[model samples]
Target: MKKWLYVLGISGSLILTGCNGNAEDTNAETENQAEEKTEEVNEQQVKKEILKAQMELTNTFKPYQQKITAYQAAVSAEEPDSETIQSTGKEAKTAASEAASKVEDFTIEADLPEDVNTAFNDSLPSLQAYYEHVESALNENLEEADFTSAEEKFTEFNNQFNEIIEKAGFPAAPDLMEEMS
Candidate 1:
């Protein structure tokens, strides 16, 4: 009978130990699940911040583009002095270049969604191309003899600039100005 009591006590202790181990295992699994959920939420927040920064960059481009367009209109209306037109074009190009640099700096450190990153990357080349076109237009010497050709080139550059804004999912310069007003 003493042996039987000893065996029963040992069996009860083993059962209690097993129950405690199971409870700990369940708590550990719950904690892991919670951590995973928190990580997902953080990733989503990062994506949101990235998108917000990108949109702000796009919006900033509009005003720079509008200034360029206005300059082009002024040049086309009359063959201004070659030096004056070139200076204005240079100033406009410099401003646009600065805006592009700011957009490039508007990056997020978080892992962005694949599609969003792809879309953003795709737009970059367009921005670069627009910059090159504008730079070329600004560098051209618009003498009396070449004024007509320069005007044509400037118009072409403006069209490319518009296309870039469209590809970047941004509104045209005029529309952005209207919205701002």
Candidate 2:
């Protein structure tokens, strides 16, 4: 009877050990799933932050696009009306100045990755430079040269800005820039 009791005690302990192993496996699987979920959430959060920053930057620059198109039309007229040119040029100047002001006030409210934040922060200065060039150019006679200068400055900004956007893992920048002279 004592031997039988000893045997029963050993069997019960082995069964409990097996059951504990199964529980540990279940816990491991749950932990892995929770980790995956957390990673997915973080990825989505980063994406959202990137998108929000892009929109704000675009808005700051969009005002210039309209005035540029108007100025382009006025300059490229079949019979260039000095009156129209002067008015459009003034409007473009104002728009550029406004963009510069906006650039000064612009802030990225999103918490992005370190590299991405640096890239984004770097982009605004280029945009400000572009706006400053246009503002100064419009102070003189509106020439084809002024438009070309604006284009060059714009290209520089665009290249830098687009690279940052791509690095953030988004689609190509939408046609944010209009047809500039």
Angstrom error of the Cα, residue 89, model 2: value is 1.1
**What shift in Å separates residue 142 of candidate 2 from its native position after superposition?**
0.7
Q: What is residue 165's positional error in candidate 1, in angstroms?
A: 18
RMSD of candidates 1 onward, in order: 9.0, 3.3
Error in Å for residue 127 of model 2:
0.5
Among these predicted structures, which one has the highest TM-score?
A: 2
Alpha carbon lDDT of each predicted model? 0.57, 0.78
Off by over 4 Å in 2: 1-12, 77-80, 111-115, 178-181
**Could you tell me how far off, in angstroms, the CA of residue 107 lies in candidate 1 after the best superposition?**
8.0
Clashing pairs in 1: none
Clash number for each model: 0, 0
Residue pairs in clash, model 2 = none
